[model samples]
Target: MSAVYSVKEIYIYPIKSLAGISCQQAFAEEMGFENDRRWMLIDAENQFITQREHRILSQFYPQISDGKISITFQEQKHEFSAYEHLDNPVQVNVWDDKSEVVEVNESTSKWFSEQLGFECKLVKIIKPGDRKHESSRLKEIFNVSLADGYPYLMIGSQSLDSLNEKLADKITILRFRPNIVISTEVPHEEDDFTTFKIGDVQFKNVKPCGRCIMVNNDPENGKLKKEPLKTLSKYRVVNNSVLFGTNIVSLNSGIINVGDEIIF
Candidate 1:
């Protein structure tokens, strides 16, 4: 049979809740895309900080090249090595999961603090396997990065197109922050995808992603708008939560490209 859908875009958020990097290709790791959400910001209490709390975070753009990761904010740039060794392992909280993370360094932490105007530290997940999925609904244990939950999120491009048709001001897929964007003619078809393959990697669709206020934030200017969510809630609300996209877990490891065929 001919391919029903094709991969349209791939994204990786090296730092949780920060602007993501769009790539032509990415390696599918057990936890998530390689170098994806491997680094994150934590406050003095070692609690994870996200765009939900600080909308300014959306203004910080990240790029990964060679062995270095660079972030640009307010016309300034900061770069750090992809790998670093730290002497202390600090306990950090990501939602309900607590895991030990290695602090990047005092200088990196200072840079972030200055950028966000708050005391925060940059930390990396030393061992992703140390933080396993805690849901009992799944029969197997899986490793995950600092993502809200699940290792992958796939959304049908047509779904966003459908949602846009209902709103006066349309939005882009970046607002949903999906890792995998599949081009399909049908809207919301991914919600029915239980198991599927892209290239040689297999993935299982787990649950519908519940929308949050963070989706209303303008990725371009870090400004909040009472949109998409307000309109989405009119029709997409379920169990009192606005729903869009679907969370997935990788069943195998491989590389996925932008134009690869999605086999269901």
Candidate 2:
């Protein structure tokens, strides 16, 4: 059959809750995209921190290199070793799951503490298998990353386009933070396909992503406002959850690129 949708964009969140980096192509690894959500910041209580509490965290943009990731905030840049010299395997609570992560370094944690103006530690996954959340849907897909629930999020381009048409001010897909953007003709078309394939990998849409206030966070200004959320509730509310995108789990591993056809 002829393809009905094509990948419009690909993104990876190297650090959970921080800014995401857009890419023309990405590798679908076990937990998530390669280098996606491998690192995250946690509070002194060993609980994961996110923009939900510190809205300004949306301003921290991360760019990953071969051996390091440079985060920029307000024109200032701080660099951290991506996967070198991991120290101290500490257990962290990401939402409800207690996943084990290693400290990137003391200096990196110290810098993040200063930046966020609080005591926090920078931690990274030792490997894709370092953290596993048991699930029966996909036997081989229990390896969850720092992501809230699933390894990937897929949003139909038409969904955002439809949402934008209803609002006075339009927003970018970055607000939704989807890893895969499929160009479809119908809004929320992603919901129609529960199983699909892209390149050598297969994916399943677990459920509609229930959004939170973090969507109000403006990555451009490090500020929060009741938007998209408030408007989304008008029509997207279901069982007390305001959903905008679909949470996805991978069935295999492979490279996906922009403009690639999504075979259903």
Candidate 3:
């Protein structure tokens, strides 16, 4: 029975470093959830840029409807196709892993670059698994999206609950940007789960997600704070890295819904 734990939340970031969209249910795929981290912003050098360096990136939120994505910055809004044209294929470096992606369009590219006050291109992966996972933590390699690494990230609700007890001002679960959140009696329980199932899809916990200063970014204001990470380092640090959630890879393609029991 898939009853030990249940899915509490599902989230997807259409563009890397941008605000995420919450969903009641999500499709599971080898690379990642559909439209999750499929698009990214790259500098002139073709190196991927993220909120880590420019926190304001989180202020731009994307919403998809009828195969189109719209992002509003300041007071202006622009829309682009979810799957941009494949004719403008380009090579990009997502932290060392090279992948082929397509430039969205001239209009959207100009809009974003003008708003961000920098010369950057909006790119989208034409297909799933465009970028292969490059991690020594796992023995086998699989495809991944524009996410830092891994296809999925799962965190227990209690983990944030426990962490909030130590924080002076608690942060939202969105701060962790997990693709899946399971309700569990214990904090960080997903860390020990090697193999599990959420709804109809089987998943494997491949590695512990090491957090960085990105966690310090305030989801609401796109401002940086010292709270969560500063407090987390005291108790969660291991091997010079502060660990929080578990990175996972789907075993098969299926549907994962909120309230779906998590079987371990």
- Candidate 1's C-alpha lDDT? 0.87
Clashes of each: 0, 0, 0
In candidate 3, what are the lDDT values of residues 1-264, reduced to their tens digit?
A: 243788999999999999999999899999899999999998888889998999999899889899999998769899998866649679887877889998888788889899999999899887765788666877788889999988798999999999999988978998999999888888887888988887789999898899999999998999999979999999989899999999999989999999998777
- TM-score, every prediction: 0.96, 0.94, 0.97
- lDDT per residue for candidate 2 within 1-264, as digits (tens), equals 364788999999998999999999899977999999888898998889888988888888899887789998886789977766466689877766778898888888888998888999888887767777755444544788998878898999889999999989888999989999998888876865788898879988777889999998877787787888989999999889898889888888999999888887
Error of 3 at 258 (Å): 0.5
User: How close to the true structure is residue 173 of candidate 2, measured as C-alpha lDDT?
Assistant: 92
Ranking by lDDT: 3, 1, 2
Error (Å) of candidate 2 at residue 8 is: 0.3
lDDT, candidate 1, residue 230?
88
lDDT of 3: 0.89
RMSD in order of candidates: 1.4, 1.8, 1.5
Q: Which numbered prediction scores highest in lDDT against the true structure?
A: 3
Off by over 4 Å in 3: 1-3
Candidate with better lDDT, 1 vs 2: 1
Error of 3 at 127 (Å): 2.0
lDDT of each: 0.87, 0.86, 0.89
Question: What is the per-residue lDDT of model 1 for residues 142-259, given as tens digits with 9 covering 90 to 100?
Answer: 7889888888888999899999999898899999898999998888888878888888999888888888999999898989999889888998888897889998988788999999
